[model samples]
Target: MARQHPEEPTLVELTIEEVKAMGKQGIDHPSTRPVITGGVVGAIAGAVLPVVTWPVGLFAGAAIALYTRVKR
Candidate 1:
């Protein structure tokens, strides 16, 4: 008869730890895509709307995207 091996338990990281890890990774992190996409979308919107500048829109979009990613 074949012997069965027990499965190991998985470790879950806290939200703060995950954020710290991502921060260490910086722009090279997986979250870069969403941030960049948000920046682009914001820039486009800013261009369309005369009130907001492209740079301001870009920063706001990136911040929002990063917040959402970290919260997840």
Candidate 2:
């Protein structure tokens, strides 16, 4: 019989924490500067593009945010 370590976190919990940490790291990255750069870019794009179609601007904002996080 195998023993289950009571003090150990389950695989799922560890995976969740890892994912959360990755998100935090992405947000904290220097290139994006999520609060100032990403947010401002996204907001501006969203405001400008929405004139054509409401959802389009929202999608553009989301893409900008993603690009900011992924950009070097």
Q: What are the per-residue Cα lDDT tens digits for candidate 2 across 10-63? A: 555654554466578775654334434445555666667645453555556554
The list of candidate 2 runs beyond 4 A from truth reads 1-50
Local lDDT at 44 for model 1: 79
Computed on alpha carbons, the lDDT of every model, listed in order, comes to 0.74, 0.54
Q: Looking at model 1, report the run of 10 residues with the lowest lDDT sum.
A: 8-17
Give the per-residue lDDT of model 1 (tens digit) for 31-59.
87788898888887777889999888888
Q: Each model's number of backbone clashes?
A: 0, 0
Model 1, C-alpha of 48: deviation from truth (Å) = 0.8
Model 2 — TM-score against the truth? 0.32
